[model samples]
Target: MVTGDLLMAARAGDGESFRALVEPHRRELHVHCYRMLGSVQDAEDMVQETLMAAWRGFDGYAGRASVRSWLYRIATNRCLNALRDGARRPRAGATFGVTPPPPTRLVEPNSLQPYPDSLLDGVPDIAPGPEARVERREAISLAFVTATQSLPPRQRAVLVLRDVLGFRAAEVAEMLDTTEESVTSALKRARSRMPRERPARARGTEELALAAAFADAMERGDVPAMVALLTDDAWLTMPPAPQEYQGRQVIGEFMRVVAFRDGARRYRLIATSANGQPAFAAYGFDRGDPVGHPRGVLVLTIEGDRISVITRFENSAMSCFGLPGTLEGSDHRDGV
Candidate 1:
């Protein structure tokens, strides 16, 4: 059935029609919420709220705006409301056992979480609008999302609508219930404040090879070899925690003193992908258990043949990627 027919049937209180109408946009809307809120859990919550609101207000939907825009309007406002209410903010950094090197600087409080590449599978790509400058991949990169964290909630919404998701200025204004001029101004400020870092150009074969090398070095407990895979100015950051390590020397020291403190401890890296980058679910064996226990998820940002950034999340993030909390020998080869 055409969308109009679906809409009419949906408005008549046919639940199946409503589901059919909205289901196609589910993944993309979740992504939109993720971009706005930065946490998969929070994004999921807001998407729920958006869909519920859409359902409740289906009778009132004027049909003038496209369904996608209407849903975005609802989702964006819900995120803004959460931000304004102070109900959503970065969680505190996960506590680490080891005492190690001093950080270069404390990064801003970021509740940023990785989005599973698997969830991105069926999300239909929308071409960038005329004024949109941010590419699709960069929009979803950890660096870009982290930079957006520093923005005011409204500006973040505007930037994501206008630049990231490629909504037009007028359309964004309508979504936010503001003037087009306001949207334009907010986009300008947001663009100016965003950190200029871009996603590394490495992709496909080069990315796989580099990630495999890092994994091999990690499994062998070779900190130096792992460090060799990093670029000279590489960064290592743990989200939710402000600590950021820069440069191969500093990062290598951090790994030696903290990550490998148990003396060449072998790790199991279950390969995965997050935020369109190669990631692994790292595990360590317990004294009695043959299977490895969940440690954390490590996401790598590659530039050319070397890793430019390494961001590790707490073990709690494993569930977000559909990773099992514990891994048996047979589970080793399966991707999460």
Candidate 2:
């Protein structure tokens, strides 16, 4: 049936019609929530809440806005409410292991999680309006998402709605129940606070090659080779761990002292993509084991020919990317 017909039937309490009307929008709405909340699990929870609210309040959805816009309106507010109420805060004091070194600055355990590129397939790429300043891929990058986490909740909402999603200021204002002037002001501030430098060469050949080299270095425990692939001012961050190491030298130390500490342990990297960047499912094998146990996921941020950031998420996230819990063939005769 046509959307209008489905909308009519849905409003009349046809569950099947309502499901049909909402199914296509679910993935994009989840992406929007992920951008706002930063955690895959929290984003998913908000999407569920948004849909429930939409279903319960279907009668209030005036036809003035397109269904997508209507749903976005609901989803945005739900995230904003979640932020304000502190319903979801960063998981605190979650450490991976012993501290590596003094960080560049004091950083809390970041709750931010990587979004699998697989989830992004078929999601619409174009901004809905002309005001979008961030490109589709840039908006979903780990760097961009982490930057957004530093903004005030409202400014985050405003910037994402007006600049990332390209909702008009008026539309954003309506979504947040504020004035267009408020949205404009918040967006201006948010844009100014955002990192001026966007990461480069996403999913391109250069980025792929860099990711491959890093993976190789990691497997062989080649500290210099891994450090060489990083930008001089590169950063290595493991979320749920407060430490963040910066610069090639410091990152190299952290790798030698911490990551490659057990000389007999070997690593295998299974290539994947996350947040529009190159990533891997890292598996580690003990001294004599042929099976590699899931360790964590390493996501790389590339700029020009060098990698600028390496963010490692815990292994609990592997299933989200369709990665296996264990891998065989530890011989490493043919490198990944």
Candidate 3:
């Protein structure tokens, strides 16, 4: 049925019609929320709220705007509300008094989560079109999301709507209930504050090769070889822990002391992708357990041939990447 027919049926309380109308936009809307909140869990919550709000208010959704725009309007405002409530601020870093390494600014910690590629399968390519300066994939990069945290909630919304999603200034203004001039000004400021350069490209045979080698080095307990894969100004950070290790020397030292301390049995890495970048799930073997358990998810930021940043999340996020809660058997080659 046409969207108009779906809308009419949806307004009359046809649940099936409502689902059909909204399902196509689900993944993209979820991604929109993720960009706004910088937390997958939070984004998931916001998407639920947006959908609920949309369903309840479907009758009142005037046809002045497309259904997609109307949905974005609701989602954007929900994110703004969450931001204004200060309920989604970055958490404090690790309690240890270790100073952040040089060249790596330990910004206030936030509830950053990795986005699995598996979940992105049906997400429409809402990337900016030919006229847009930003690449569609780069807009979803972890680097871009992290940089966006620095923007005020409204400005962040403006930049994402206008630049990232390729929405017109007038349409964004309508969504935000602001003037087009205001959106333009806010977007300009947001652009200035965001990171100037996109991080190393996440897709390519070379990138895959680099990620494979990194995973191989870790799996084989080759610390030196692993360290060689990093740039001199590399960074290592575990969020909600606040401790950021910068520089290859500092990162290597910490890896030796903590990550690889108990020989190669400490952890095993399975290659994966998160936030559109190379990532891995680090499974650590318990003292006597036959199998290693999920420890944490590590995402690497590459620059040229070397990795510049390594961000690790607590083990609680294993399921977000569609990983098994426990590695049942010795065979870890499932997802690699």
Candidate 2 lDDT over residue span 1-336, tens digit each: 998899899999898998898878899999999989898888889889998998999977778888888999999888988889987766664554655667776686667889999889967654458988888878899989999998998899888888887888888887888999888889889989999966556456767777888888888889999999989899898887777889999988877767766476778898888998899989888778888898888999898898989998988788888887788878662335
lDDT of 2 at 62: 77
lDDT leader = 1
Q: For candidate 1, lDDT tens digit of each residue in 220-260?
A: 77889999999999999998888999999999989877787
Q: Say which prediction, candidate 1 or candidate 3, comes out ahead on TM-score.
A: 1
TM-score of each: 0.94, 0.94, 0.91
Q: What's the number of clashes in each of the models?
A: 0, 0, 5
Query: Which of candidates 1 and 3 is the stronger one according to lDDT?
Result: 1
lDDT for each residue of candidate 3 in 232-280, tens digit (9 for 90 to 100): 8788888767567888778876776567654645566777788878889
CA RMSD of all predictions: 2.1, 1.8, 2.8
lDDT of each: 0.85, 0.84, 0.81
Candidate 1 residue runs with Cα over 4 Å from true position: 197-200, 286-289, 329-336
User: What C-alpha lDDT does candidate 3 achieve relative to the native structure?
Assistant: 0.81
Better of 1 and 2 by lDDT: 1
